[model samples]
Target: MPSESSTLHTPAEARVRPVQQWWALSGRGVAKVFRNGEFVFAFVSPAFLALCFYLPLSALMDVYGVDYAQFLMPIIVLQSVGFAASSAAMRASFDDTEGINTRFRVLPMPLVVPMFARLSTNAVLLVVSLVCAAVACLIIGWRPMGGVVGTIGLFVVALIVGLLLGLLADGIGLMAGSPQATSQALVFPTLILGMASSGFVPVSQFPEWIQPFVRNQPISQFVDVMRAADTGSLTWEILRPTVWWCGGLFIAAVLLLRLGNQKVRA
Candidate 1:
């Protein structure tokens, strides 16, 4: 007669494949975003920013020889991307605080799968946010004059930036002591960076003392490249600073991820 253990299933038999595991978690994340009304905020935020800023400020920008609607599109789109990233941070913090991530640690899956799943969900939201921002821009009289290649480049840059920011935010969520702290930590930096950028006004409009800082900051570099791409005037010189900024963001994200993983292990 066979022993009882011989007839029972092994732990390995019960384990799911890593790919399946990743997809399942990703589906869960995406479903939560939709079910909890995150999609509604995803649509509302860019539209709100576009209407609030464009209507009152278009005439002021026109006086300075700038087309406000067109000029505001990049920053508006970027702000939506920022919102998506912030949402990712909040989700990460919730998962950690709720012990979901801790439960994930005991699962029969690769350690990186959860992170990748979160990334996939973030990507989905990022695209949705971008589309909403584009619609908002259209309503405000912004047109894509960038031609096919330049337009593609414009979105490509936004995606890259958004993903990096999302990763950074993910790390912040993992390491932050609480969800409220994560939200508080993100608020000032986003505001300071967005407002100080060359996105809304000409660099000359900034105080002469701060012009040098405003001209060379990461946000300003991104805006310059985006604006150049919009006009089909993008050149290597205009893109160099953005490349450097991407490299810095990449390094920061990697470091943050490492730190976050350490915290999780602890």
Candidate 2:
């Protein structure tokens, strides 16, 4: 048998695989989300949004010949997406500030493992948020006029959009110095985009000058695609802008993530 000193000097045979590292980190993230009460907020936020907007504005929207519940579903889903992205940002910021990221860096894990793990956590939260939003929309009288395929397409669009947003937000969180800064950085854009978009009301309802912006903005484009998917009227023209926006978001996320990786290594 080897002496105690020789055993201590020997390299261990056991090695942690990259997939195991990713899974472990993802489990940790999911646990943190539950422990921090973010999971509860995932349900509450969308339901509250649906109630607040549908109650006050349904009659007003009816004046425009809009089925308000149907008109409102996309925005509610998108808002939930925003909520998930915000949570991701906060998680990334906390990891950075608390030195959790630095600790991970010192481990034998790949640089991308933690990022992918966070993305898995974000995806899980996004799915929950979308489900909660759907329940809230149903309670508010939204029904799927979209056939089976159309309805599926609607959710597929929502999922893709949510995942892209989560990626962008994750990068933002890593780049931000603190959780407060992360929240602040996300709040304005989320508010301005959500409010100013045709998501709440039609472009015709906006002031003439801003109507142009409202009609063409990325959020509006997303809303338009989702609505079209719901009604089974999605066309190349309706989808083109959203595709472009998704591409832009993807590029931006990649750049930010690369920068974040550099910062971590530094």
Candidate 3:
């Protein structure tokens, strides 16, 4: 008979195969989420919210020039990803309450499976929302400065940012007792953070007190970097701020995920 010791491996090896399996599980979960009417509603309803918000900005189109659309396009993508990522937290809290975690733990699975599965699923939803947004932008007369490739790059950036945000949200859901509270607590930050970008209005037009800070922020820099590849030329000046933001978020995400791991699902 094989020794019991032969059956054992380091936690490192035990975790490796499970992580790969977890990613495959995430792919299936995302496909399932797309089919759920309720989840689809959660995914697409925000574009409606945007149309209402865009009404006031319509007249500004004449005053600001069609150029405004170029800037607005990137903002919509960023906001879509940011908002959708928060759903991962809500989903996690709901699943935990439903006792989904217990069943998952009993399976030969990575404990991180459900958490990231929901997150990756929401990230996929954000991609759908972005395509819808691109359509809206074209219908409303928005044009990208860079062109097709540049616009696509902007979408990619939005997805990466959304992925990081979803990871953060998953951690948030784990620590908070209720999804409503966690979701609500996150709303303020989400709204305010996007405002700091160049999408809503030009930074040059912002009040003297607010202009300096928002202009220097990551979202604005990201908008510039992504837009440069399409509308303008790609340069370090445009890419640097986005790079910095992603780097910071990467560290914070790892730390938060680590903290959440202490909760032990069983």
Best TM-score goes to which candidate?
A: 2
lDDT of 1: 0.90
Kindly provide the TM-score of model 2 when superposed on the true structure, using C-alpha atoms: 0.94
Model 2 lDDT per residue over 67-160, tens place: 9999999999999999999999998889899999999999988899999999999999999999999999999999998799888998998999
Looking at model 3, which ten-residue stretch has the lowest summed lDDT? 37-46
User: Which ranking of candidates, highest lDDT first?
Assistant: 2, 1, 3
**Residue-wise C-alpha lDDT for candidate 3, range 179-212, written one tens digit per residue:** 8778786787777767766777778888889887
What residue runs in model 2 are displaced by over 4 Å at the alpha carbon? 1-16
Residue 105's C-alpha lDDT in candidate 2? 90
Residue pairs in candidate 1 whose N, alpha carbon or C atoms collide under 3 angstroms? none
TM-score, cand. 1: 0.93
C-alpha positional error of residue 80 in candidate 2 after TM-score superposition, expressed in Å: 0.1
Clashing pairs in 2: none
TM per candidate: 0.93, 0.94, 0.82
Give the Cα lDDT of each candidate. 0.90, 0.92, 0.70
